[model samples]
Target: MSKIALFGASGTIGSRVRREALDRGHQVTAVVRDPRKITEEHPALTVVTGEVLDAASVAAVAEGHDVVVSAVGGGDGPGHQATIKPAAEVLVEGLRSLGTDAPRLIAVGGAGSLRTPDGAQVWDADGLPEFVLQIMHAHGDALDFYRTVGDVRWTCLSPAAQIEPGERTGRYRTAVDDLIVGADGQSRISAEDYAVALVDEIEDPRHVGERFTVGD
Candidate 1:
């Protein structure tokens, strides 16, 4: 079992991932902006309340970690930018300032950068709701920042066309760059299965120095 430093533990994907990490017998230290917002109490986990947007705070929690997985989304509760971009900027610098080549860092990326049915890459747009688009751009910026890490091990996992809460059947297909859409005319995967891929990728990275997308 590895020791993982997790950010955004109170969020949707982060919450599930924190549970999954603990369920697998791994140790987790969740760094959060507020303590009251976090309600999970795990004997194997440590909840460190701090600003993910502060490189010093993030570096403090990231120390002695085997891996760092960020599931943070920016919003005031789903439609604000105050939470995301700053976090990305901080995480990037935090990893850079670690000054140690020990932990592997993987942040959640966006499906918006993936290709669409038109064979063209899509980008974050204003048409999408504020909450939906916030993380898209944030992740995109995060991944872009990671590109300059020089020696950090990173894999920005881009999800399929559709990602939401659902059942975990322990099965899903993986693809790189483009969106993975099922023949049924949809591209969706449960958060459970998404966590499966995320953990698997964490354990063994097949997309290092690159980005990949998941689908049915």
Candidate 2:
């Protein structure tokens, strides 16, 4: 079983990933700000309380892991959606301080930056709603940061345009640098399946130093 250090373990996608990892018999170190929020207890799971934006804190929790996954998201409040970039920066710095790049990093990214078949970014698509623009921009910045960073072996997994709580079919399709649309012409995936894809990638490395998207 691979050792995984997961940030934002109490969030929607993070929680799913944590469960999937444990179900697959992997050792998971779930890093969260509040340990009480994560009530799931597993023999293979270790909960660590720390700040994702602090380099030292992140590094301390990330030590001795085979892979690091960040499933962080912006909170409900307005303008709080831009934390992904800062968190990415801190994660990179923390990983670099380890003095060895053994633990590869994978981040849960937004689908707004994904490219359509016509080559237009989802963020720039016509008639896009204004409310989600900030979150999209933040995720775009985070993806850009990962793309440009050289020291860390990182990959950003962008989910389908519409992600929600649904059944885990343990099945999905993946595409690199472009959006994956279903037969019905919509891009979507369940949170549980997204976690499945992530843990699958963790077990077998693909899309290294790049971004990939998942869809039903």
Candidate 3:
């Protein structure tokens, strides 16, 4: 079983990812700002106080873990500009301090940078609110940062256009950069299934040192 370190474990997507990992018989360390926020109980789960933007804290929690999953700002909008890109930098910096023994990093990404069927990007679509644009761009910026780093073993998984709490069919399609549009012309994936894909990736390495998106 893989020893996983997870940031933002109290958030929507993070909680689902934690549950998925624990259900798969993996050991999970739920790192959060407030440990009391994580109310779930699992034999393989351990909650701890930590900050995603702090390299020291990241290193402390990341050491000895097989994978470090960051779900920070995965489904938020208010202050993503401050956390998303900065968190990416801190995570890489912390992991780099460990040299060659650092665990692999899997960061939750956004769909804004994905190319649409017409070749335009998702963030280029009209009628998007200003705050929504900020969050999307924040993730885009983080992805851009990840691409520049060749030393760290990192994988960014971007969700589809729409993601919310739903059933997990344990099935989804994936793409490297283009948006995965189904036959109905809609791009979407339930958060549960997204966790399934993330854990599946952890179990089987693919798209290493790159980004990929998922959809129903």
Better of 1 and 2 by lDDT: 2
Query: Model 2: how large is the Cα RMSD against the reference?
Result: 1.2
Residue 202's lDDT within candidate 3 is: 96
Q: lDDT of each structure?
A: 0.76, 0.91, 0.94
Off by over 4 Å in 2: none
Per-candidate Cα RMSD to the true structure, in Å, reads 2.5, 1.2, 1.0
Q: Relative to the unseen true structure, what is the C-alpha lDDT of residue 189 in candidate 2, on a scale of 0 to 100?
A: 99
Residues 139-159, model 1: lDDT tens digits: 666667767666667777777
True lDDT of residue 123, candidate 1: 64
lDDT of 2 by residue, 1-216 (tens): 999999989998999999999999999999999899999889999999988899999788888899999999846567666678999999999998987755889999999999998899889887765658888888999888898988889999999999988999999999998999988989999999999999999999988899999999
lDDT tens digits by residue: candidate 3, 61-141:
999999999998744556666789999999999999988999999999999999999999999999998889999999999
TM-score of each: 0.87, 0.96, 0.98
User: Candidate 1 vs candidate 2: which has greater TM-score?
Assistant: 2
Which candidate model has the greater lDDT, 2 or 3? 3
The per-residue C-alpha lDDT of model 1 at residue 159 equals 76
The lowest-lDDT stretch of 10 consecutive residues in candidate 3 is: 73-82
